[model samples]
Target: MTKESPLKTLIGLAQDDVDTAAQRLGRLQRERGEAEAQLQALITYRDEYHARFTESARAGMAAGSVRNFQAFIDTLDAAIGQQQRMLEQADARLEAAKPEWRRQKQKLGSYEVLQARSEATEARKSARREQRDADEHAARVLRMRASNP
Candidate 1:
């Protein structure tokens, strides 16, 4: 069995880094999407609740009921604001992950380029060796025929 070269080991390590970085970026994107979805849901619920509250106030509502409705709406506003902040934070994290992923991908690409060049050079050397062997065999055959004749 042939021993692995340092370049092969480096390529493996680079590939692992790229995979890990991509996973991290993907996870951050998922978290951002979930945060945005939750924010949208909260906004939709708040809008529907406010519409109902408006209709109830126009028809009739006791003082206590009005106060409770207003307070609940205020609470919903605060929660919506908090969710917006969370979504912003998730966006920031996702943005941060992108650079690392790009860096890892570039490193892997560099290693792959080196590997390709090395393989190409080795193939040329092998072809040269094969040509030399064939030439030597032909020369030996010619020498043997001359001696026999």
Candidate 2:
């Protein structure tokens, strides 16, 4: 059984960490996008509702109806405020995830660089060994031919 190099093992683990971090970052981004979209929808709905309320008031609503419209608008405004807060929280979470993702990727890159250097060192050693063997073989052949002559 061949033993795996420690650097290779570290590289594998780093790759897994990087993948996990990337997935987490993607999830955070998706959540933030969904929150932002929901907030936008809420704002658009509130604006449309306010416009309708204004049109109705101009068309001569009763005092009770005017109060009801104002109350409902206030409720919509409160909901919009809550949605804005939710979106802000989502944005914060997404921002927090980014650094972790970058760190994991950097670790993986460092491992890869180490592995490349190790391979290059091995190749140089192999080349030197091959040259030494060739030189010894040529010297042995020359000595044998001179002895026979």
Question: Using Cα atoms with residue i matched to residue i, what is each candidate's TM-score against the true structure?
Answer: 0.97, 0.92
lDDT, candidates in the order shown:
0.96, 0.94
lDDT by residue (12-45, candidate 2, tens digit) is 9999999999999999999999999988998899
Q: Write the per-residue lDDT of candidate 1 for residues 1-149, one digit (tens) a residue.
A: 99998889999999999999999999999999999999999999999999999998899889999999989999999999999999999999999999999999999999989999999999999999999999999999999999999
What is the TM-score (0 to 1) of candidate 2? 0.92
- Residue 110 alpha-carbon offset, candidate 2, angstroms: 1.2
Q: Candidate 2 lDDT (Cα, whole model)?
A: 0.94
lDDT, model 2, position 133: 100
Segments of candidate 2 deviating more than 4 angstroms: none
Best by lDDT: 1
Error of 2 at 125 (Å): 0.7
